[model samples]
Target: MLKGLGESLQVTLRKLRGLPVVDREALEEVLKELERALLSADVKVELVQQMLENVRQRAFKEDIPPGVSRRDYVIKIIYDELTNLLGRRYHPLTLVKRQLTKIMLVGIQGSGKTTTLAKLARYYQKRGYKVAAIAGDTFRPGAYDQLRQLLEPIGVEVYGDPNEKKSTKVVKKGLKYFEKKKIDLLLIDTAGRHKEEKGLLKEMQQIAKIAQPDEIILVIDGTIGQQAYAQADAFNRTTPVGSIIVTKLDGSSKGGGAVSAVAATGAKIRFYGDGETIEDLEEFDPVRFVANLLGLGDLQGILQRIAEATSTEQQEELMEAFKRGRITLQHFKMQLESVAEAGTLRRILSKLPGVGKGGPFSGLPVDEMDDESVKVFLAILRAMTREELENPKIIKGTRIHRIARGSGTHPDLVRALLKQFNQTQAMLKRMRKMRKQRGVPGMGGIPGMQGPPF
Candidate 1:
């Protein structure tokens, strides 16, 4: 999603950094490049012009603080401007504990509304909330079946009447059904309708009146680009849309357009669907999103995930070892296991500074390894002796063969695992040395390395 835009912006930034001196002319050139990139990504013309103007004004007017390079200042200005374009802050879906929060989902047809409902259900369920979903979309064929198939596997109960044609009645009955269940969150999946469908809109209004939902979310399809504005505008006018969810962003090159267009309408984008699975939806964070676009990496998100995957004592111990510039196979194994829950290997690597495109690990094959491959690597490690685990240099040809046999893998896999381990160790050692030279302990003092606010 918006990968091309990100790459273009990265190239422009690289060019700006390579210049001997960044004058007003160079700044203008960068802005032009940025404007072109945003336009190509289907961002609204007005929004792109506004963002470029802001960048230009700030780049020309702001004084270069002492010790801060002019290139860095320009980069900061661009980042700020882009973040503003995408809504300046994160808008989380605030849920009250022990409260039955009724969330009504509305969107156009084929916008991935049903799938997003399942994802939302999984998200709340993982947070220890008693969540259930109501499939009020009786217009679409198999709407009930689809919702049931997606939600039931994740332990979220779904209520719907396939033969019931009245969406309002279905919602009313579903609400009544859950009233006695003590459900913490009830997600109502309303039928998708066009803006001009007066009959459908009236039905939606009646359903809303009956449900009295705490939040009415408008789900937008990212592939529609700027055309999403019409749907968002129409829905907001029909009933006050509390928030928005943009779906199918994973492969949509026009995702930028969808996001920017919706933001322009003043409705907060609460979440976005980045993949096909139930766990693919993520809360939209403006700062982190802009950082990834500018190739700065999501350091805050990564650190927070790491903290969540490890205990405080484990964190302190790891920090101590990192400070000492020593990372044994044991530590590596722990990190791999912990990061498995964090996200995919590519996602984790992309969040690391100097590990993304044109970064230190850009050419590394570790990003190509999936979860199963990682598990196999872990198994190979488990087959090794304590001595070999501690000192990988002792693993010879026969030792590698024996471990591979024990782990049900080939010797080449064992060698590949060792190579990856060595590469990771080397990268960590280099980072530690760089931090030491800067008089920082571990990675704490590094820019963008701070943990997220829990």
Candidate 2:
């Protein structure tokens, strides 16, 4: 994750978080912080100034939505602006049926092109694409061996010529070799070259002519600070780059140098390699990226994750409980555990409409149930019998004592948990009535419990 920029944005958001009306002066203060954050992230000064001016103009021109507060609206504006700043969206690589797509990887020296090639290979390979890789980086000593080691174990066909010095000739031979097979995607990894390295740059250009790739992917090294922009520009100038991949982003918090780089290359960033592992590559989705960057926890992403991770039968059971307007100790525990499962509870709550600071559930005691406390509550839940869990009314006096003993906790602790559950149930009933007043649809499922730790 882009931690540095994320923290800066979050700090800016927090400054306006509870403010019902964000006046001109307050917004200016926040914008200054935002400008600093983006600039620090290696975003170009011109882009940063333009974004701030746009944000300022929009704040004055735009009206807050009917339900959303001014603060939330401002946050939305920032999110939209950030999304716009980051290429808007990545160009999704869609493999055509019964068609062989060729992709050429080119980048400056030590930009992690070879590893990215393997990651892309695995990414396509897992999706049932007949993927193959070509070791066109003949200048590198262990380029062929490295490509082979990465792809061979994964059952991806890797072609290379150790004897060949010319990258263009190697790529030509590789294309001829893979043409006989039913390969879907042929990835050609060209040797690393600098903007100053005319010979290597020429070799890359020559290879592009020889291979006539469907897409020329320019890989930018994320850790190179602001030099990423120059790197992308040089390659694109020599041979037009179709799409870009940013590598070595893991633990990178200082800046997103790719911002200026994308502007220079005029290419949509397709993928980002976040870690050393092949599985760490992800689509550079601006929406989710900005949403997560500001710690808003990507609401749609949360919904998608819940759909993927939870079963329909389980959802139905939870939905039934919500419909009855009575959740058992089990349902309560599920709500608590679900928050623990999805990152920090604060983030999940931030996405909810009027919940955390200036919302309806502002003082809902979220601090009481942290991760450790959730674990204890879950343990207490586990100690209860099926009937007691389903109908917590039975767990009084001796039953509470028994549960406490069984769960290795004090009897008062069990009582405290029971009391909190009662309080939460009452609050949820009030919320349901409010939802009805607001004409919101019946909310259910494990995802319905996607906010505020306990």
Candidate 3:
């Protein structure tokens, strides 16, 4: 989703970095390129122009503090403007413990409100909350059953009177029933409507009055583009939208439109649904999002994942190699050890830059290789000298045989290790190339690395 926008943004930034001096003309060209990328993503023309003008004004006025380069200064200005275009800070859901926190969801019909309600319920459940949901969408034929099937399996009880005609009455009864259940998070799925659908809108207002939810959440479809602003505006006008959730981003080229549109309405985008699965929801963070958008590859997210996946000492060593933008046999061994403990090689491999299933390292066994295979790799790595470990490329056919003899393994196994090492090195080279392609920093997710990252 918005992959083309990212690519175009990267290209613009790359061209900006190539300029020898930061001047008015160069800045103008870069901002124009950025404008095209944003427009292509269906961002509203007025918003894009406003944001670019902000970037231009800030980039020229701010003084380069101390050691910062002029190029970096301008880049930082652009990055900040883009981040502010979404939202300056992360707005998390207000979840209270040992009590019922009622959250009512609202959106236009066919905007994924019900599906997002189910996913939100699942998200809270996974985080140790005692969640329950009320199917207040009585107008929909199977709304009650849908909520039952989606939430019941996860141990979240669904409260809905399918035969009830009035949504407000159903919500009132469901709230009273769940009051005895000690539900921590009570979700209310309201009826979807058009801004002009007075009947449904009245019902939604009635549900809100009866439920009196702590928060009113608006779920927007990512494919709706700039029209999302009108929907958000209408809902906010009715009940004052507290937050937003964007769905269908996995299939929407106009995701930027929905995001920016909601942002324009001054509603904090709390979460986004990237895929259809219940677990596809993610908390929205503007900095991480903008980083990924500009092809910086979610460096902060990658860092947190790596820190959780690897041991502290191994994490230090691995991150050191990341800073250097190289992976030796020693680093590879650490990765295998971590994989053995975590048993999540696929999880790690999938997030790595340019090294997923069909990536440069695709030929290396990802899913098929098991614990026993890891042991073999460790034994072979142990047989190598420091020089050989540092520079595995120098180890040819003869060195492979020698290592096999030292480790008491077959030469074929040794060759396999070397092949994987080559693949790993190739993957690192590709990551470094991408990192260097960045017009600003945060590409490889390394904190102290020198040079701008794409």
What is the alpha-carbon RMSD of candidate 2 to the true structure?
18.3
Better of 1 and 3 by lDDT: 1
lDDT (Cα) of model 1: 0.76
TM-score of each: 0.65, 0.64, 0.63
lDDT tens readout by residue for model 1, 319-389: 56655667677765655554443343234244433221221222334445566776788789889888988
Error of model 2, residue 211, in angstroms: 1.2
| Best model number under TM-score | 1
| lDDT of each residue in 86-202, candidate 2, tens digit only | 765436778875689999988776888899999999999888889999999988799999999999999988889999888888888899999979888999998875545465566
Error of 3 at 191 (Å): 2.2
Q: Which stretches of candidate 2 lie over 4 Å from their true place?
A: 195-200, 237-241, 298-454
- lDDT, candidates in the order shown: 0.76, 0.73, 0.74
What stretches of model 1 exceed 4 Å from their correct place? 195-201, 297-454
Model 2: worst 10 consecutive residues (lDDT sum): 353-362
Residues 116-173 of candidate 3: C-alpha lDDT, one tens digit per residue: 9889988888888989889988988998998888877888888889789888889999
Distance (Å) between predicted and true CA of 281, model 2? Answer: 0.8
